[model samples]
Target: LSDPFVIIELLPRHIFSSCVEQQTVVHKRTLNPVFDECFEYSVTLEQCRAEGAMILFTVMDHDVLTFNDFAGEAYLSLNQIPGVDRGTSNADNFHGLKEIELNLMHQRDREHPILKTLESRLGDKAAQDFMKKCRERVTNF
Candidate 1:
């Protein structure tokens, strides 16, 4: 298992195909590419203090030739979807919501054995009421 502090790529969107028009950079840092050339990567942030916490970030990719540099970057102008994750907010963010939760839910998915057992033990009426309360809680979030 990877250490918590050992930051690493969580997705394959780290690398992309762009037309290299400039110099002869020769180091392959691409995720799956075996090319003879790879760009020299570096980070040059001076200061990033958040609530007295010193932060350090890195330059994941930089394409000087394209106008879409912010394509893979974070954008904060989107609205949050409700009843999806108990919702995510900017203050604490949706940091607790996992990938699967954020990607929408499967309506017709089979129930787990635990869920079946609980439904049997709790009775359908009680389970329905509990689920209704859950949905209400999510909606009110």
Candidate 2:
């Protein structure tokens, strides 16, 4: 039995300053949890077209006494999302219903260049602390 939840992040390529994050409510003791949630980010269409811009979904198991455990993760490119490149003139089209099923993966690039760059920033205590928390969330000990 596990308490599962999901963290969703909107990351723009090379623009770490504008990352947006959101999360879903934890569903108790269920392996299959349906998260009917929506998140909105204030970003321009150009930002969505930026190379490597993506949406990252990380699922974790909640623990009352200890830190949450990483379950899996999925990544979706911004360009792949519906209505991003098509313009948002029609609010209806922009907000049109589109469903996606992502195949979660257990392993992630721990030594990713971005992660290394973020870790190397010793001056920003907040970034350092955020990175530490991210690492802890993904680490299962």
Candidate of highest lDDT: 2
Once fitted onto the true fold, the runs of candidate 1 whose alpha carbons sit more than 4 angstroms away are 1-101, 123-128, 131-141
Stretches of model 2 off by over 4 angstroms after superposition: 13-16, 86-91, 94-96, 108-134
Native-to-model Cα distance after best TM-score fit, residue 11 in candidate 1, in Å: 29
10 residues in a row with least lDDT, candidate 2: 87-96
Cα deviation in Å at residue 67, candidate 1? 46
Per-residue C-alpha lDDT of model 2 across residues 1-141, encoded as one tens digit per residue: 889999988764355456657899999989888998878887777788788778889899989998789888889987777666565534446455567779998647877787788888999776787588577767631
| Top of the candidates by TM-score | 2
Q: After superposition, how far is residue 54 of candidate 1 from its true place, in Å?
A: 28
For candidate 1, list the clashing residue pairs, or say none. Answer: 27-38
Give per-candidate clash totals.
Answer: 1, 0
| TM-score attained by model 1 | 0.18
